[model samples]
Target: MIGRYAKLNVYQEIFKSSDFYRVAGGAFLIPVALLIGLMSNTAVIASLSLKELVLIVSVLVNGFPIIMEAVKGVMAKEVNVDELVSIAIIACMLTGNYLEAAVVSAIMVAGALIEEAVSDSARQAIESLVEMTPDTATLLRNGREETVKVETIRKGDMLVVRSGEIIAVDGVIREGATSVDEASITGESIPVNRLEGDDVYAGTTCVDGFIKVEAVRVGEDSTFGKIVQMIQAAEESKTESARIVDEYAKWFTPVILASALLALLFTGDVTRAITVLIVGCPCSFLLAGPVTTVAAISRAATEGVLVKGGGYLENMAKASSLYFDKTGTLTRGEPGVVEILPEGGRSAEDLISMAAAVETGSAHPLATAILRKAGEMSSSIPEAREIVSETGRGVSGMVGEKRVEVVSSDAYGQKGLTTVEVRVDGDVWGCLCMEDEARPMATKAIRDLGAKGINDIRILSGDREPAVKRLADEVGISRWHAGCKPDEKLDLIDTCVGSGLIFVGDGVNDAPALKAADTGIAMGLRGSDVALETADIVLMNDGLEKLPFLVDLSRKMSRTIKINIALSFIINLIAVVLGFAGVLTPILGAITHNIGSILVVALAASLRYSKG
Candidate 1:
């Protein structure tokens, strides 16, 4: 029953292709002509029979494009397999085998369309982003809601999204609460309850409740738009294996044509030569690399891993060493205040409130951690004024009458501790120790990477040596370098330059190393904009578990391409040998070629089932 359903789906693919209808309308006349010839023996032209006239029309509609491509290929000094099939169609016509000529042309055309449908299956996930995008959005303005085109929305525009509607832009909720089905964005099925101030992305459906969202990114700048663009770019990219196939194809087509010429000259059998031409298109071999690459990329996307291109997947499969950024990558990225110490008879709440007040409106991980602890430990956080922050150092502001400062500290060089001094006026009010724990799957992910052939696993960080070391040991990584500045990380990665080196990082500090590596993967959920833009691949779900999955995917893609090519070669070789032996007719040869291409395409499409 499963096999029957699968066969039905294949037939559906053939019928649904728009090319099918165009070719069918012309080719459908062949059977009608055959019926008329049997009934009346009618001649459309004085010198041509009805079957010949029908064949010409079918060739014009179904075979004309391929024949013109063959002509263009010759003019461009590019030899392609289309030339072989084109010559075969013309040969059948000259021999007055009109029925076989029309049949072969239609079959070849149908095969190409089927290949196209199968190849495009890779973009199905990305294409759904476009289809799910709502064209119009309800704009809330001056206490009234106006329905307008989503394209007209700009940054800062408030959008009122209700239950069952797809959010049209990436924005922050300003009012109310709702459960959003973020499956389109993150591939997580369970609808998540979103409160006021929570970030929402475009294409995520509002499951229930209502919210007024302030648009932050819209149109092409939206996350959905950027993802679509990335997937399209990935599909258009050609891998190294694909390039090799193209180079061989340039030489391979001529060899097949030479064999056909030899058969015609030696045996004086035009039918045998035509059969060889019909079977020698090499459609399966030509499509093997790209189909496998696209399928692998699409499969990876489903697991929330966005690969930038096929070349990256090819590069990743060969990676031997992996470099990691300690914070916000292998770690959960959410820093929490571990312990707070106060001086001058002050309570811990007072210090946390002062630090949180000054850190308010800051996006730094440390600042966020401070604010989060304040919300839990302190009753109320006083409003801060005149806040100023020094890059990579600390933040200072006027909290009430006293000047509060949260400056970087090296108090305890202990494992995973990040301390910041809380100063009241010029005197130290004490310090707050913070820690970012390793992700729940970090150890497992690292272990899996080793199995996948990532030999050298190293950690790079600006944190204290003890902190970096602890996290490294926890994740089973023995090689680690701490206190490395941005330029230092860049220099380290440069020294490790090789074909398969990968650097995983999450912030601006790691951007340089990411760009320097063979494949750079960014933690998309919490990654800085610089990191996201610089990295070649993004773990959209922000899970380290996907790392092993990604590595496995890349290797599998490499293997799948090889397997597909081998299958194509074996099938085509069998068909060509039969053609040379005069055992296959032109029609049978065309059918065999179509079957071979379809089999290869099916194998490539099966790559979508890759396990994460």
Candidate 2:
């Protein structure tokens, strides 16, 4: 009985506090009362008439809030549209135009409420991302499965994700096969097949088969958590246009107040002055940028592109040059052994077996390709001893009785294919010519970027000059820079900064360059965590096809914002002129002002449906 009473009280409190209920009640009550007043012959209720009762009710419900806010703004010495609207309502009431006062106040409150709803609805995409992560995880502990809060699931803990359940953390599948729906994270509608050793991110659903995932990142360190943080930060960071509007409002509000006073002195009519105040409020001006920005950001999120903020989106629209890291940005980053050349009468099997044995524990992309090739050949790799790796050079270890080393051919200044020279006991045994294949979408992405007016395309790579030149030509990029180290990449980015560069890369070495560029886009699937952290944007599914689409979307959003600003200015100007000329009454001025606000919001919301 106590619990039931408490539940009833909670329900009662929620209903009273809800803005929807308040707005809906006011909206419904006013129209129904107006209709009944029109139908009745006398339209009388108690001592007051129907319209008189409406004027009192509307003033109490809507005008009181506007008046209170206006008073606060004045006390703080900050002038705004609310002050102008409040003054207009007061003036109408003083001039025996109570109906005009009610209408103007109602319009102001209703327009603001509706605009808030639209903005809130547009931001639901980011909110949905926050809700995607489940609260509990099925943890595999000591050969038994137990449920625990996701926060308690630490790294290295094994999580058993059953079919039709959301994966609790970012991890690698240790056993079993499953198809995962990563649409919440990557926005890819088609479920991707995940086998042993394949990565599964947090918030993805296991759709087909059960799998045990060894957690790599748990809690707020997961990719989904980082994405949510990025989005929240993005929403808080304002764009250039928003800053301009804020500055303009400081003067615009006072200017409107001055115009109202001047009209009252010259025309000697309070109604004309009130009309001026009503039409001159900067409703459209305030909303022109943020609405478009929010819609564009939301749309980008739905397509698997996480833009850090509206400022980046604004900069991206004006990007003049595009810089790319050749290996992972343009190419697939997965190099495959195309030719295995044997030297000194050594068989191909002997060279591959020795190389694969030494590279068994390495996480390099080339090592992965070699291991895959060895598996395909049905060769059993013997364990290596005393394995040592040199960054950007090679790996050396003892394969059985022989000392084996796999070093880059670039170390000898020889360039044909990107080869790793296999040495046995300090003698060259053979070289494996590996090729990192260019993505099929690379040419199309470049072509589309050029079509969108981004002409200066360049490749800054650490690879040999011949390979870089070949890739640049193949990808239709005219400018190319080869043999760039990590610092050199940063230097190149510095030179392009003045021209607004959009740098795309996926390696740990690319992290510094990514941070230096005007806009950095990281390939989330295979990119280093440092690169993803420093990048301003992330292509979640690592699809280059979306590059051109992003550019197109940015340009479209820029155009839409400009259109909204211009439309708002023109509408406000026309309304101000009509109001000053006594052609627009107080009620008409309020209606026109509300209409302008609605039109601007509607135009900005249209960006949500725009196609690339």
Candidate 3:
């Protein structure tokens, strides 16, 4: 109940924000006051023109916030459109054109209200992510259920999660088996079966399961918590384009002011100068960068793609060449032994048994693949004793009276498959070739990215040539380099031409390259902490499947920003010319000026629904 209220309260806070309320109230009263003032011009209420009286009141009311914002900008050494909008309103009043002042104030107020509404709605769309996990956990202490605050949950606490309940922690399923929906965690909507020893994450709902989980991570340490933190941090980070727009914005007010003064000197008309200020608010122009960036970031977050900043997101559209790490990026990290070849007159079964026994106590991916293949072959796996593992090498142990060893080998296998050499009693017994499966979306992502203008796709991997070549061909990539170390990848990154270079890899071995590339996208699920930290963008759910979406979003945002700039300049140029010719009144100039701003807001807000 408390959690429900908290989420509701947050929803309400958007409407109740200071900007929304002030602008909303003023937007409503401005029109009403105008109608009243127009009627009272003839009635002459209280021996004064009520139209003029109420129009002044409305102007002051709407103009107060604009003035305050302008003052704040001055104090902060920033000049924004508010400063010009405030000037236009003041100049209208000084010229005794109360109706122009009121109309101008009202138009700017309406624009603010519209912008506020769009921004609030975009924020509301992603804020519900916090509600994915329950605030309370049903603790299974001593086999009795006790509901406790999720924050109070600690590692190793056993919790009971039933069907229709959200799992409150990252844990191992200790008992029972049923289906679980990890869409909230992995972005895959399909519910998967969970058995004893299977892992479940917080925010994932139990579709039809009654299970007890032993918590391994609780509260902010869980994956869901980190995603939320990433979203919040992304909100504050800006793109390089946005920063550039802001830096150039300071010159706008000065240039506009100079233009207005020169207009008055040349035309000998005060109204012309005031009209220049009114039309030159530059509200739409200034909104070009920030509005688009906010909406794009918000849209990406809800789709399970967490972009660190607009700068990185923008880089994706500019990237010409995409370099991918073969393991865990193009291919699923789960390797499987595909073929068992015999040597020294030994049977394939003999080689499989020796390899499986030596790797029994190890947790490496290669070891797991060998064990899995042995099980499928229905071969009797012997228990190995005195096991020892070497990093970057293989494991060795005593399998009964026969000595067994599994070591890395340069031996070649079927094209693009990894090979593991097995030894029996210090003699070569044969090798097992393992293949990392290509992701289902790998080919599609490559093709889609090509259409999006990232045509030069390649693979730079530490795997042997055959493994790299096979994955490259499977994924439709033409260029590939095998056995390239991290430093070698950097050498290739520096050679890319055009807009930029984008590198996609698991964060572990590719951290330096990820940091060096123009844009780095990490496969979040299989990526290490180092990869997650180093990459600019993270594909949280299905790795390769999300790439096209990211590229689409970045390209659209860039195009939208350019379109907004062109539209704003064109509209303002025509309006300013008409104002100089006295063909546009301050009231007409005000409407024309803000039309551009409103259009920019709408274009940016549309990005939220682009995927749909």
- For candidate 3, the 10 contiguous residues with the lowest summed lDDT are 1-10
Worst 10 residues of 2 by lDDT: 1-10
TM-score of each: 0.85, 0.83, 0.82
Best-to-worst ranking by lDDT: 1, 2, 3
lDDT of 3: 0.78
Against the correct fold, how does model 2 do in TM-score? 0.83
Top-TM-score structure, candidate number: 1
Clashing pairs in 2: none
lDDT for model 1: 0.83
RMSD score of candidate 3 (Å): 5.6
Report lDDT per candidate: 0.83, 0.81, 0.78
Q: lDDT at 322 for candidate 3?
A: 89
Q: Show the lowest summed lDDT stretch of 10 residues, model 1.
A: 1-10
RMSD of 1: 5.5
**Best model per lDDT:** 1
